[model samples]
Target: MKRYRQFEPVLISGFKILEWTHPEHNHNHYEFIFIREGTGRHIVNGHSFPYKAGSIFLLGPDDQHYFEIEQLTHFVYLKFTDAYLCRNSSGSTSAIQQLEYLIKSRETHQMGFQLVGEDNAIITLIFDTLLLLRKDQIVNQELIWFQLFTVVHVLQRNMPELRSNSFKSRDLQAMFCYIHKNIYDPNRLRI
Candidate 1:
């Protein structure tokens, strides 16, 4: 298991042209991948799924994956960590905790989203905004947060099970405390 870590509290965004250069990899952070214009088969833990323009996939920590590109693909990736999600928390049910449940409970092999019709248009609009914002090196943290939340929320709306309100408050509180207290302590992190 490769544990790629992000030290800073910021969303990592990029556009890549696929040439089958990178091997299958899994990391410690959460990944939101959008296929901007491409045709490909996404391989997750040996299972294959077809993907095209507007395809969205969420890779949580430990979701091993790689892509088999069929057409020259333009892939966009948005990566972040729980620490970043928790940075602006104000209450018990925060984005980090919502994301914790969303990420940890999902099947590693599941493709997170499929775009269609109006949904496709709307998400693509948001995707374009995020790409533009990243390109300009803008410091609009609130917009970044909202955009990421919209992505996650859209995925949840598509998957009914993901929309379940099952996280208990005490658990979120405890998890928040544990994460904040030991974020810089690797030894404590190991526990």
Candidate 2:
């Protein structure tokens, strides 16, 4: 029941179709929402976007957002903290790279069409990770890190547009800082 924040990188929350409705105005940690079935509309920063199966929406820290379900939807919500991303894994920073790009993008960037065919695989992986996280089994940190990277890799491979711009460490840090400062107050974010 801990609220998500930048200090803790992962949160596993599940929602059924009937539970879908407007949230009581709050910010997010790094968020990944996967719609397994049905359809809905996501309202973020005054914009209403359509959400169907396989729809993946990424919300950075402090981003005020919510969803209204139009059909029966099954989804998993993952929220991770920024501090968790800064930790280096082996020699590669793929997780950091993926997270930086995801956070830098606009709130609610769609990944693919409804959760069908290949997209179902990604959804399954996400659900699997959520279950693993919930279990809290004693395991190597590296394994957990790799699991996180895999999620990012799946997302990037699925949505080429999200991987378009290469980012430097400083740029990503600055972007995250800006998001942290303005996400709660959408009026302050010009973009």
Candidate 3:
């Protein structure tokens, strides 16, 4: 029932766990979690599923989840605030819009990623690359931005329902994001 808060735009950290430290919880930001090694049941939004190594999943601000570790689990979390997405949006608006589309459409992506074989390897590689880029405090913002987009690109290619042709138009996605962010402001919501 608790919701965690994150002030930073992006953070990458990993740890091994015998059991989850928190109870069922959601976050103020979004989280992209990779199960580097382990076996467990991921109880997400009341839906439970088994996960092992290479189990990748995403959780938006409103999604509630917790892990039931059946064996020792190593979790690498790539957490980012919505502000991260907004700030990271360079000139290419479509990609960010598409990602926002996925984030808002809970039924489409809340369960996370069910990847395997080469796909698993590729994602692991991307995350590993990100881990390295994030260390030593010499982080290249552009490079990190690109790699994060790559992860989103990979997710876009794999989620059949979110095929490029089927994605909401760029302007529509933008409007939705705009509206969602300014929901409390009547002036901002006005056309």
The TM-score leader among the candidates is 3
What's the TM-score of every candidate structure?
0.74, 0.66, 0.79
Predictions ranked by lDDT, top down?
3, 1, 2
Instruction: Evaluate all candidate structures by whole-model CA lDDT and list the values in order.
Output: 0.73, 0.63, 0.81
Tens digits of per-residue lDDT for model 2, 1-191: 12333445555676677555455354545667777677878776557788886777777655566778788888777666655565544466656776676566553253333445765776677666665666562353555566666666676655545335444556888988998988989887776
Model 2, total clashes: 7
Error of 3 at 9 (Å): 0.9
Model 1 ranges with Cα > 4 A deviation: 1-3, 91-98, 105-109, 136-138, 160-191
Cα RMSDs of all predictions? 14.0, 13.9, 12.2
Expressed as tens digits, the lDDT of each residue in 44-74 for candidate 3 is 8999988898888878888889999999998
Worst 10 residues of 1 by lDDT: 160-169
lDDT of 1 by residue, 124-174 (tens): 888788887775445777787788877766655566553353445567788
Q: Measured by TM-score, how close is model 2 to the native structure?
A: 0.66
